[model samples]
Target: MREAYHKELESISEALVEMANLVGSAMGRATGALLDTDLRLAESVIDTEGQVEELQRNLEEQAIAVLARQQPVATDLRVVVTSLRMSADLERCGVLAQHVAKLARRRHPQHAVPRDLRRTILEMGQLAQRLMAQAAEVLITQDVDAALQLERDDDRMDELHRMIFQHLMDERWHHGVETAVDVTLVGRYYERFADHAVSIARRVVYLVTGEHADDYLPDTPVIH
Candidate 1:
């Protein structure tokens, strides 16, 4: 029975990794749809979001069952609880990807991103995907160093998000208010997606090290 309980714990970890992988792929496809204004791809992303949601629900159910039956302790307990939070973050990441896809579908042939800003948006999307992929690695490997690196990586996404707002607020901007709003929303979605990736990585750090990321002092050894 103990062996079975441990196996269930491992399954939870696997599910979290799977969630991360799914959300990462969703963001990548959503970015393509956004850049190319591909309605079909956008529709594909929108339709598949239910898969992410279903995965989250299944994970939660399994986690709750483990907690009730096995009553995990110490690291085992952390694994189950952290997996729950990480799944929540992954679910949110999936939703953000869907939002990006919907924006592409809404804009249709016109393209949601203007040509001048497409490069920045593309960079944001790529960064978001990379961060999520790294987060998944951290989840599976429990590599605290890689998890910490995700925080640094998120800085780039934040920079790109600021760049988008700067262009929108520029007095010389040619795009109308509607286009500006669309760009702003899209930038926010990418930024939040990166944030969720970082959050998941942080949770992994906690699971591995038993140290909450926020508890560290600026020059602490664990962080470096």
Candidate 2:
């Protein structure tokens, strides 16, 4: 029975890794859509969000089954709960990416964002996608150290988010409030996506160490 339970747990882990890969792709596509104003890509992101949610639901049900049937011990219990929370965060990250895509649709044909600002957003998107990929890798390898590295790497995303805001604020001062709101919201979606990725990393820490840890500093000026 214990052996059977262990096999089930391993299956759950594999499922989670699969779900993470899909979520990471969603984030990547959303970012690409935002940068290139690719309406087709944006639509694809929006369409695939349902799939991400479905994967989350399946993971949650599997976790509940493990808890109910096997009654995992402390460590295994932690892994189950952490995975549940991480999947939820990852789902939200996908939603945030879709939100960015929605925004991309709104400003179609009229590129309100400056080319330099678009480049910055592209960098921010890359960082978010990288973090998502790292989170998945940590889960796959069970590498606590890689998870810690991902946690630390979130700081750079925060920095890029800040830069976006500073630029938007500067725009407000110079270009007036015309494009300020759009810029602010775009910066916010990227920052929040990073935040969710960080949350996944922290959950990874919890999964391996049975302790919760955060990667970013508080008091950073958020775009929202």
Candidate 3:
């Protein structure tokens, strides 16, 4: 029974890793499409959203099966609950990517974001993607150290997001109001993407250590 329970745990973790990879790719492609003005890439991100949702559903079903069949207790119960939480986070990440794609589609003929802000937003998105991917690896391998290192990456994403916000606020103060709203919205999307990645990392911590990380916020303070 112990061996069977361990196998079920491993299966649950594997499913989570797959879900994380899908979310990471979606975020990366969304930012890439936005920066490059590639409508096709944006569309790809939009199209893949359904698959992410389906995967989340499947994971939830599998997790429920584990709970029903194994009746996990203590640490095992934490694994089941953490899987559900992480799946929800991954689903939200997909939704954020869809929003980015919608923005990209809206501005197909011209660039939606300003040139100065593009690089930073892209960097933030990339960091979020990296965190998602690394968090999956850490979870699958049960590497607490690697999972903890994701906090640093999340910090970098937060810094980029704050800088983007500052740029938007500066523009709002000095420049006209036309672009500020859209820019702020875009920054918010990216920031929320990073925030979701941090949430996934925290869930992984709970899965491994059986305790939730209290430090949910990234290292950097809000600048704007």
Candidate 4:
């Protein structure tokens, strides 16, 4: 029975990893659609969001079952709770990607990204996409070290996000106020997408080290 219970727990983790992959792909495609102003691709990315939602619902049901039937304790208990939190993070990542796709769809024939900012926006999108992919890998491997790296990547996303504001503030800016508002929203969407991915990684760190990533110093020797 204990063996079966543990297997169910593993299944929940597996679902979370799958959610990561789903959102990662959605973000990549959304970035492509945004950059190219492709309505078809944007619609496809928007459509895929339902899949992410389904995965989250299924994961929740499985987790609740484990908690009620097995009554996991210690590490097992932590695993179940963390899985729920990570699932929410992954689901939010998908929502952020959909927001990107929606922006692209709204812009339609024209580029949502101004010409000067295209390169910066592309880099931000790719970085956000890669962060979620890395988070997925961390989930599968349960590697605390890899999970920690997501934080650094998230810092780079923040840098790119700030760069967008600089462009809007420049004296020669020509994109107009409407485009500026759209750019601001796009930058925020990518930034939040990366943030959710990092959140997943931090939860993984907690699962492995039994300490929050902020508090746990992997290099320090324990006094006890």
Candidate 5:
């Protein structure tokens, strides 16, 4: 029975990795669809979101079952609880990818990203893919350093997000309100996707160290 219980825990870990892989692929395809205005690819991403959702639902059920049956403690308990949180983050990442795809579909042949902002959007997409891939590695290896690196990656995404807004707010902006709105939404989707990846990485940090990342921060020096 002890061996079987360990296997179940291992299975949960495997499921989380699988979830990350699926969402990472979705984000890549969604980015392609957005850049090229490929409705078919966009639709494919939107459709695959159901798979991510299903995986999350099934993983949550499995985790809950382990908790109820095995009553895991210490590291074992952290594994189960953290897995649930990671699944939620992964699911949200999938949804954000779907949102990107939907925007592409809604815009259709016109392409959602304008010519001037195309490079920035492309970089954001690539950054998102890299972050998710790293997040998956962190989940599988529980490498705390790699997990901390993801936070830096997220900062890059945040910078790109700000760049998008700056362009939209430029005095010479001429993309029209509709294009501005689309760019705003797409930029936000990519930013949120990276945020989710960072959240998952933070959870992994907590899982491995038994302390939240915030716990390690130096206390603000008290002013006299």
Candidate 6:
């Protein structure tokens, strides 16, 4: 009975890792769809969010069962509770990804990002993919340093976000208000996606060190 109880805890952790992977893929594909204006890809990413949410719900149910049936205490209790919280972060990541895809779908055929700023958006997307990958690794390895690196890397996402606004504010801007709004929303989605990814890493860091870490300061004024 004790062995089975530990196995259930391990399964919850495994499911969290899977959630990280799914959200990462969702954002990556959403980026592609946004850049290429591929409605099909955007639609697929939007569809996958439901599956990620399902995983979150399942993990939550499993965790609640452990709490009620096993009555875990100390480390075991922390593991169950932490898994539940991390699942929330993962769920938010999925929704953010879907928002990106929906933006791509809403502006199909015409690129959501202007040609001048597509490069910046692409960079942000790549950074998000890298961050999520590191987050997933941190989930499995519980490497505090890797988690810290994810926080540092998220700084790039912030920079890219500000760059989007800078382009919109420039005097030569001629993309008009509609496209500008789309670009603004896209930047925000990627920024928030990075935030949740870092949050997941911090969750792991807290789980491991029993304290929140990472305090790197930014030089530039971050956009929101």
Candidate 5 lDDT over residue span 1-224, tens digit each: 99999999999999999999999999999999999999999999988858988999999999999999999998899889889989999999999999999999998989778999999999999999999999999988999878877886688899999999999999999989999999999999999999899999888888887778677323323222
Q: Residue by residue across 45-123, what tens digits does model 4's lDDT show? A: 9988688888999999999999999998999898899889889898898899999999999999999898889999999
**Model 1 over residues 86-130: C-alpha lDDT tens digits?**
898888888999999999999998977889999999999999999
Candidate 6: what lDDT? Answer: 0.87
lDDT of each: 0.89, 0.77, 0.78, 0.89, 0.90, 0.87
Q: Which residue pairs in candidate 5 have backbone atoms (N, alpha carbon, C) closer than 3 angstroms, thus clashing?
A: none
The TM-score of candidate 4 is: 0.94
Q: Answer with 1 or 2, whichever has the higher lDDT.
A: 1
After superposition of all CA atoms, the RMSD between model 3 and the true structure is 4.0
lDDT of 6 by residue, 1-224 (tens): 89989898989989998998999899999999999999999999988868988999999999999899899998789878988888998899899999999999998888888899989999998899889889989988988778777887888888888888899999999999999898888899889889988988887777787776643323323333
Q: How much is the lDDT of residue 106 in candidate 1? A: 91
**What TM-score does structure 1 among the candidates reach?**
0.95
Q: What is the number of backbone collisions in each predicted candidate, taken in the order shown?
A: 0, 0, 0, 0, 0, 0
* Minimal lDDT window, size 10, model 5: 215-224
Q: What is the TM-score of each candidate against the true structure?
A: 0.95, 0.87, 0.87, 0.94, 0.94, 0.93
Candidate 3 residue-wise lDDT, 49-156, digit = tens: 688889899889988988998998987898788889888888888898889888888888677777877788778777777888787787777765566677666777
Tell me, by TM-score, which candidate is best: 1
Residue 185 lDDT in model 2?
A: 78
Off by over 4 Å in 3: 1-4, 171-178, 215-224
Task: Write one digit per residue (lDDT tens) for candidate 2, span 75-173.
Answer: 889888888888888788778887888877777755646676887878888888888888778888877667667767877877888887777656355
In candidate 3, how many Å is residue 188 off? 1.6
TM-score of 6: 0.93
Q: Candidate 2: worst 10 consecutive residues by lDDT?
A: 215-224
